[model samples]
Target chain A: MHDNAVFSHKVLPFFLLAPQLIITLVFFIWPAGQALYQSFLIEDAFGFSVEFVWFENFIYLLEDPEYWNSVRVTFVFSAMVALVGMILALLLAAMADRVVKGASAYKTLLIWPYAVAPVVAAVLWWLMFNPSMGVLPFWMDAFGYDWNHYVNSGEAMTVVVIASAWKQISYNFLFFLAGLQAIPRSLIEAAAIDGASPFKRFWQIVFPLLSPTAFFLLVVNIVYAFFETFGVIHATTLGGPGSSTKTLVYKVYEDGFVGLDLGGSAAQSVILMIIVITLTVVQFRYVEKKVQY
Target chain B: MVENRPWLTVTRHLVLILGVFIIGFPIWIALVASTNSSSEFVSGLMPLWFGEEGFGNFRRVLTNEERVLGVSVSASWMMWNSFIMAMVIAVGKIVISILSAYAIVYFRFPFRKTCFWLIFLTLMLPVEVRILPTYEVVASLGMLNSYAGLTIPLIASATATFLFRQFFMSVPSSLMEAARIDGAGPFKFFKDILLPLSVNNIAALFVILFIYGWNQYLWPLLITTDENYYTIVMVIKRLMSAGEGNIPWNIIMTTTILAMLPPVIVVLGMQKLFVKGLIEQEK
Candidate 1:
């Protein structure tokens, strides 16, 4: 990692690194340590008493049905988001990559949604599905079905999933498009010269070449769905309608902030930290392999 | 590109057109809702056309101070808070990360690798995972309801530092050697040569970080109990929950448009830099 030439300094380098180090220690490290430590203790809501019950929190969480439900909900939410978001983005990117004209224009239209906040996205979808005044429900009523997310748990999950996935499609599309462009043109043309049909060439060459990007996006999208979809849950469902839409991250907020269950919330945080660390490790390992290849 | 068949070209255009339409549908609905009067949304489906109360809704949402439900501040005040928070975060991250990255790249020091790893650890610990403890720390420090509470904790970014480090590594060693031969000290060389070269990276990072800071929701929600300190993004949630039927859909949509306007403008106006920043940071 060293440069061929470098400046020699003792105290100055320390000073240069001080601001970032200090902020990281204070905000990130300390809080994470506290979460780890507090997860072992059970205290009353008012902070009146505390008992060092080392594994009780973990044991209780393991046996808790609601916690298990949250895990199931999170998996479903994350899988749906990753699948829907990546498929739409892959389809659009493949199309945009094929067209020689107006590519940038199509990109501009497709990518602006990346800038819209998740909460705003949730609000947009919420407005569209608002049973009475919403356009989608109005159309649903025109058919034989009724559409109300407020009362239907499955519908609540669907709306949150759509809103979260919709905001992420732009990001995935950019990456996939970049990946598609990076594929050597000669390889595809060579395939074309070998009497391979367009669909055959794509399946045999382009799709296989795009797998790395697909895997990377899969990890990124799942992490996003797990953590960043907090806004989507907060704005639309609040994990409501009998906790049908409550993901793990949302449950942590609910139990910690609103429910005032400190020990349980801290325990949940530790679990989330483990999940994030695993995902990040997987991402970096794959990224390093990609670099080598 | 290998074979330009007319039918293939038509199919490609059709697929892209349909994708654009689906992507644009929600936004179009929001736009339509923002232009109409609230009364129009009482019993029927939302109108697709603009109504007579377009500017009236925006003006009321922007300047009106009367309490609707949970909103205690005007839309303009919330927007201002959001702007300040975003600016400080974007600038603070660049300055701190650049300095640290410079240290890691150009100089030799004790605990250098230790510092780098420590900073890298922050990337794994996002705010959402440790929200309760972080809130407790901020509360104990009495930083709640203050700009410092809103921005400082969020400014310590591992991704920004990594980006700057990657950029600094690519700079030629000759520049530094020449500057050293010219008797330019570290600060002088940095100011005269390094900063100028880093302008594009800084601009790209600024656009991405600005959107990131502006769109923060849960952190601001936890820290800012005072209505005056509420950011536009957080305040909108309050507006949504306050008055079920009494909440004006038009005004809420107007606030949504205003909230997303700055970041959207930055993305569209600086599309290239944004794409560069986004892709580079991920790398």
Candidate 2:
């Protein structure tokens, strides 16, 4: 606690952090700064001259119809996946919470998908959703239903959503299970003594208290959907069947990386960053207040 | 929270079991599809037994034949690349995080708040924003098609640093004081006492980063232009496409199963620590 000891502490920390800072700056911070710089201009595929065009890249991005389509698809995918993923996780968590025996086995089985790489998951889902040879589609035909994901945009969205949800369900379950265990047993017993209906008791007691955990899952899931679904979108659809599956991240990758429009890509990245920062700020500032924690 | 109402007991059981089955069904089908032959798989039969096609499917998967899109040599190489990159990144992250976290927790530095908040800000910027510029940096470093390109950049992990910093801050200050009074320096104090006590945090970070590395798609896809640099996931994808002859459902599924095995084994093996590790952070 003395001045010399405290000051010495500074030296060690600075030395340890110095290498990491340079690395982070060279790799992360500076790239992000460069992306910000590039967003103001236009450039060729190989990133040649990059003539500064002021706000023209932003103007083009905002006015583009494909860009808007991606925005809509992104939010829809995020909402459905996050909301459904949370509900399924909550139910599973509640169920796992009540198991008298073999809880570990159930937990092991349920959380396995969380371990599967998204790339592999994308492959599995792609093979599973294949029209002719896909197991699910085969079953659909066997059961006397015409199922074609290619023609139906809803079905295509559903396929990706299900794949996404399958992975998220396990994660949500793990977190929710932890949150469930953390809730004291005495609280539920008190609710019972008040003669609250089972449904009412859950809504009034469990749901409200569980909001913080739910909010945690919600933010994570939204972020996961927003950014992480790129591989699946790339492998399975390639934004195909008339570009129905293209989301925000994919759009950025397409414009920025694929189209070789470095400025446009950089611009998209900036917009994406702004949107994420704003959403995160909103989550932390307002909705987080309702969370019990 | 325990419910006094017995109704929840049955309802919970029903819902949980049902959810488990639905969750498990697709995987079951995947396993089944892997077991059967191409014809049986295409037929989508429900019968499950040791089929004559199991070995046949294996042969077709490993060998190039009629209707069999071969699992490329790249599968093995990519798996190795991914495994090495993932392991190094994981170990590097833990070490860097330990030092950074220790400092943030035990020291009173001037840029302390700035360092901590810098990590928080990075968390919000997902890989997409950095993909373009990070690509430029990686390519410029001449690390393209090299292991350094895959692993080194990933070594600067903000998430791990943040998690460890947060977790270490919660360790009782008394432990550090006791060690310090014994004339133990910061490094000795951390190595001997602090690190040993934080196994659960280490395990949590390991599981998280392992999955992150396993699932890293865009980075690998972009960084390595060569087929040899592709991971198993990419291998499966490249094989399953229509151009490489008939995309065997069985071969693809088997490849998928193979791709999934390590991570599945890891999760199942470490399932106890998986939940316990995360929950421990709450305390």
Candidate 3:
């Protein structure tokens, strides 16, 4: 890309890149390589003994019910989170787009949640549905409905999903609003002049044009739901109520650290690494396509 | 407006108002909870209005030296740690990423593409994926319970590097030619021309990276073993699980509010830059 104008420095470029490269090698590449290596080795509970068992960890994971359950949990949680987050954000963004006044005010109010840490978001929701002194539970009691997330797996999943999705709405809303604003206003005016209602205009003109953004956000939101929501689940559910909310990532931590199943944990880490690589590749590919359009 | 639709305009405002309320409901509850006494929290549902204990809760949380979950550090100390960690990570990412991006964009070095790809590979290796081995590496290096441990591993950002790279590529080549003809060295040109031009981008990236650094939970949780090294975000979870009935909800809520305030202020204050960084980073 810089074929025309170039800087000729032999050692300077290396000097410039040294800090990042050292950190990446030390923190990222080396550890990832270790994970790959350790995934093939089964270690005993004690630190003394280890055995190389190629593909045995993967085989064991394949046969393990908890691993499968975690896979199921991650998918279900991610689906619900992406769906709820995208829908709510789209609705709010559409509304914000239509408003002539106080649009920035609405944006300011809605976007602050993006700054709230996921764990803090979890705490806020946890306090709200705390079951003992929670307002939601207190209100639900009048309707003969229970709101305790402690004992109920479904309720626990719902809590984590809502907290995760709530934290993501601000991000999705910002993107959707940008996408909406980027669409030519003349298109909407022309559609309206043709007697198309606002609903028809949105679907026929706006929505289709916003597909690239929506697609990009779908990938991003799913990746976020997968990797970033670890804090939400950790702070709120701790994968609680018989591992009901335990995602694959959580299980990796639990198995590696708490359960001390290093082989299995490493195997899980390898799997997670593969998933991230796939998602990153997909995002880059889609981004390239969007650039072309 | 496109068409004179009174009902449509009214509906838009109504929907946006409702959206704002739904989004704000939990924070309102937290705020209200932070303002009430422990007895008030135990009596029933939390009060909707602020109580007399608001200042007291914040003061106690900030000053109390008692250990919660064996973390003897006060909330203020933890917040300081968080502030340092966030600032370091944000500044570190920006500095290193800009340098690397500049190298990649301007210099034709050996293994340049390889270096770029190596950095790109880091995008797939988040802290969560390689926690055990990374922890072992950090532990082996004896970096635990230190600021370096908390911020360094997380500082190598592919997104920031790529962003700067994109921005540099779009910069006019004639500017560089002009500088070169004026006998300006690469470093001088970078300092005088590139740095000034990149001010908006740096600010935008700072807004994003600061929030990112501030919001980090899992990494800090893994690296820090000492109470002195605890970050505000990491300690909040521990406080939540300190004890079910023993939790000082008011203080915890106050701390949560405190922990959230800075980044929220940054986002609100630099709205334009934050938005620009976010959209451009994704691109």
Candidate 4:
């Protein structure tokens, strides 16, 4: 996309582009290159010696059960978050679209959680589900149920999923609401006049029309759940209870920072970068398709 | 509007109210927790209403009147650090993005496509993915525990640049042509016409970027070892892990509220621009 009328200054454009280019090189490209280079080299204990190893770190990761566990955990976590968050947001958005009064008020109230930081959201949920003096645990105790994320792996996953999904609801809700409002009203009216129940009309007409938005949000939510929820798990669970809740990103941090495994962490970083590139390509393809339509 | 369905309307209202309650429940609990004293949580469930200790808890947390876990940084000081970080990031990103977008759109120079692709490549390299090396880079540059380390690396992303580029492409070519015919240089044209035309977009991007900068957790946590550079968001982890046995729930909750306040206010106060910026930037 180029503008026809232009300035013919040679050095001026470089001056304009210098800041962004330099930062991209120093902070983004160079670091990424280092990760790639370091992934191929292994550092020994005590930081004394370095050995060149091609794919050994990746091979080690592939054979390691712990790494597999993290992969499975990340999948489960992202799937749960994207599924729960999108469904709840869709339900709320459908109801919000139907209401004729105080719609803006409801919209305002619902979307503010999007602004809350992931760590802050985690703390809020942690306070609620705390086993000792939390109200929810107290209420559940009366019903003959125990709640302790501290020692329970499944309960810990549940806590992180809830907190992460809670923050995402507002984002998905905004998009779904915008999608719903964009459909021509006459289509729904015609379906209703043809003796279709509201439920039938929604499934037949509205849901199909909303699929593109749904697909777009699915990708966004997956990326978010994968990358952004590190803080959520870090603040509350720290991927604890025997590494039950450690996603790939958290595993990288854990290995690199806490465990001091350089090559392995760099390899993990390389893998994550590949995932992000693939997702970015998918997102861009969808945007291009939307443009074509 | 299409049919006479009074019962359906009532159901919609009921569902909406319930949804709002579920969304608000956690924050309500956090607010309630911030109001109570530590001893109040010793033997009972969390209080459902306000406690008499609300004002004192907030005052104590804000003023850093007492030391907890041998560290006594004020909530106010952390918030100020957060504000400064957010402001520099938002303004820095906007200014940089605008200049790059302008150069790409209005002028065709050698390696223009190369520069555009270089910036685009960054979309695939989030700070989370390359954390260790990025930290090493910042450390090698001696930017650790400083505002530049916290904000500059983050400002390198291409989302804002892409948005400005899209907007610039939409501007009529006749505006630039007319300005050129009137003897206006590139700088004068940009300052007089382009800057004025971009106010709405600048404001919208500012809102989104400010929230983004303020909510950053892992980057700040990694680089900032100095207590003075701690941001409101990252400091919560320290607060949680500190004070081994007796967790100061009241003070932590108070800090959580203070951390959440600015971004929530920004979102609510500028809901329209925030929504528009979000949807457009994703494209």
Candidate 5:
């Protein structure tokens, strides 16, 4: 009964948490666990009742070349998006910081890309990048590059990466600008007084202080690349140009929802979860420790 | 003032202007696209300015088979469905996370640290991992295609819990103590004292969660398959691959513009809240 008092104290909290717990278990945990479990099974594509076929879905997925391709695709896409996104965001944020006036107006303009839905952004870019009529293509042909994302896998991948990065750079800029503003101005002044070159001061002092924020954004940008940018890929590339841009998430959508291979798709989803969890664990256990608390 | 450097200042302004134009141009395209007629769009050329076809395009988008929302394609049904679903999730998350955070942060509690880490585990196991089984679980519960199935499964928001804990931990303990000293019960102390202080966080959290829920394509696509149950995003996606007869760029752009409204409004409206909440990195 002594333990009951603590429970009683939690009565109010229990009420508050109950709804969240119930919903989380229902919507969040259940679907994910279901996906993981089904990854091991082979279900009739048409019907619900089926024999419990264990590990068959996974084995089949392993043999399917597309499955392995998706893993590689997910990696390359995420790496490119995350790395390029961080650099662009940092540069833009740095530039924004140096503006003498109308900083808010500049930020508002800069963040407009983030405001558009991924579908709209993709479509907007699609229209603007259309080879015959797209502004970029139209302008580039004046210089004779003959750029078109529709036919070339590399070009398609480049478009996907650029679009994803463009959307994300605004978010990163917001985070980094906030981070930069939070940094003490005195440190930079001191570095300048010591006759440190601007680049050296940025590398040594500013970059180190920005590590925690960078670390936080690394996790965010990685996840965004994994889950969020699927819309962009779906709308923009449709995993096209010979499956060059076929990301794991896009594959999951195509296989499970589009192709009716729910079991096999679940297997890929499980792999995605594993890669992300492993990355996160590594971040917390190793990289996070080095983040200077 | 006499010491001001001209070259650096001019260079900075130039960079800022270029950045602004890059970021601003796409939106200009979207806004302009809405104004364009189908003929104008297909003519292989569109000026940066408006085209006066907004009404006509809006009509076609809503009436076309490709219409993703409203009474037409039953996507409007999904919008309301999503709005309700997201609200339920938002309310559930905010209440649970804040109270849980309050329990751990403001009070002496047993196993509080363990609870913290346990909740954090959800952050690792994403909805993507367990989505298939959760589908079965909902099906088993006979909640398939039901409102409960759509809303309940993804309700445990690790992000909300995490943010709330961080916010609550920063709150001064003296306030809680004073409320307790005033004979306020735990409930009163929590409700009367704690919840008010966290309103800004709640607002920020609400916008983020709402947008996340609103934009969800995979989960909703997987769970609800009925024509009457598609979300706004689902509609846009469904319209994307339609036959050549239905791929009207004008209508697509119009509906796309429509779909963009809620998140845009939410973000623009709560700009200050989001700005305040998202603290910049300290150097």
Candidate 6:
């Protein structure tokens, strides 16, 4: 794919590239280097004295139960978001795929959620389940079920998960719908002529063909649930109901900004960087394979 | 049409309607809440229907005279900030990305791969992960509470650059040869031929990047301590955490509606380009 017949420019190309390279160096690479350096040193209380603590910051984080809880919470939260979001989107996309009339209307109705900001999504759901004057809680009260997320850890997690997952459904649906539409119509018709049930055809033929799209969306959704959802948690729970919804990204912000634990937060940032890099690598590998197909 | 199962078709419509309902429910609730008066919420059940105060609420939120209504900054002011930030980020990202991509693809530059890899390194380190140091750097540079502080650090985009690079590579090399034979230099070819060809790609990227910029929350929340620079998206967080009394669901909902309106319109209006840019990013 390389363009061998290129212009032989000397300083012009460098001039063109300077803005991006400069910003990347100053904003991205510099700060990342600082975070890595700060992760290895512990600053004193007054911000005056500092001591190099090598692996101590990481060791302390690893030993801390709260950090472990955050890891558990992150994985659990991401899993629920990916599963709930992807499954619901797959159902909707499959249905929309099957329908001929009003498919675009259904699409227009569905994909608007992708435009709503994460914080705005949180606010929408927060209003719905407000526990006092909320619509859902008003109905739940009749069934003898309490609906407060402020006090219940599980409910808090559920609220953020729903807000996060709801915003993601539109994206997953777009991909899944595209994937579904790309499958050959004759394949399904051929299977139906053989007397295979619709359910069997879907599970065997459609789903197997859609696995590539499903896999791509899985990685994308997990990355979204991990990092892009900082606003969702920050605005609503603030990682509260006693740190129940404090995923790794939120914990990094809380520790670094609010708690002002420079060394520990930097260590956590390093870990998150590793996670993001891993996810990017995995996504690119899948994408390359997908391009071939 | 694959099978003549009538029941299955009905089920499909039903499922799609249900999905649309669930997806549209929150926006509906937000819309309904924005229409009613603040005192209406005192009676413990949320009203599911439209209220008489719809026009008044939107007018108040959109007008600059509503600062005394407990929202320190007017919704209009915040929305203006959001618009500026979004436009700056989107336009800045596109300009820088296209330039760098053109440099890498069209010309033989030294350390070009190194520069590309350096830009790629930013894909992993989002603002959320390296919050403190990035803030420190921005603050030290005297960029806090300004538009530059809000948009510049985020303008260096790897995805946009990569997208443009891929597009540039696919452009037939013969086009460049023809341009060169016609006495056009690199810049002349880029300006005349390449730019015209890339207009569609630029438009598609603009739609996606505009929504991305408008929906930014954390970065603005970090840098913009002054209410003058508060984006509409970031303002909601402050409004929610203001206090315990009254909660002001009407004004807040109105603000939420206003905040989401532009991006929602963009996404709905440019549906084709939006979807293309989204899938293009992944590809």
Which has the greatest DockQ?
3
Residue-by-residue lDDT tens digits, candidate 2, B22-131:
88776676677777766654434433444566666655554444535443453445567668777877787788777777777778878888987766676667777669
lDDT: worst 10-residue window of model 5 chain B: B274-283
Model 5 B-chain TM: 0.84
Among incorrect, acceptable, medium and high, the docking class of model 5 is acceptable
Residue-wise C-alpha lDDT for candidate 6, range B130-207, written one tens digit per residue: 888899899999999999999999999999999999999889988888888889998899999999999989999999
Worst 10 residues of 4 chain A by lDDT: A1-10
Per-residue CA lDDT of model 5 for A99-150, tens digit only, reads 6588887777666455555655676676677665567777788897998787
Native contacts recovered, each model: 0.79, 0.54, 0.82, 0.80, 0.41, 0.81
Q: Write the per-residue lDDT of candidate 1 for residues A76-174, one digit (tens) a residue.
A: 999999999999999999999988899999999999989989999999999888887888998989897799898999999899999999999999999
lDDT, residue B237, model 2: 64
lDDT of 6 at B55: 90
- Which numbered prediction scores highest in lDDT against the true structure? 4
- Local lDDT at A200 for model 6: 97
TM-score of each: 0.98, 0.91, 0.98, 0.98, 0.88, 0.98
Q: Per-residue CA lDDT of candidate 6, range A1-293, in tens?
A: 44556888789998999999999999999999999999999996468989999999999999999999999999999999999999999999999998888988998999998999999999999889887788988999999999998899898899999999999999999999989999999999999999999899999999999999999999988999899999999988988888789999999998888888999999999999999999999998998898897
Each candidate: what lDDT? Answer: 0.90, 0.74, 0.90, 0.91, 0.70, 0.90
Candidate DockQ scores, in order = 0.80, 0.51, 0.82, 0.81, 0.41, 0.80
lDDT of 5 at A164: 80
Score residue A9 of candidate 2 by CA lDDT. 64
**Of the pair 2 and 6, which is ahead by DockQ?**
6
In candidate 3, the second chain superimposes onto the true chain B with a TM-score of 0.97
Pick by TM-score: 3 or 6, better one: 3
Cα error, candidate 4, residue A283 (Å): 0.5
Better of 2 and 4 by DockQ: 4
Candidate 4 lDDT over A103-185, as tens digits, reads 99999999999999999999998888888888889999999999988899999999999999999999999999999999999
The CAPRI category of model 4 is high
Q: Put down candidate 2 lDDT per residue, A49-132, tens digits, no spaces.
A: 668899898899899998888889999989998988899889788778768767877787788888776656666776667676
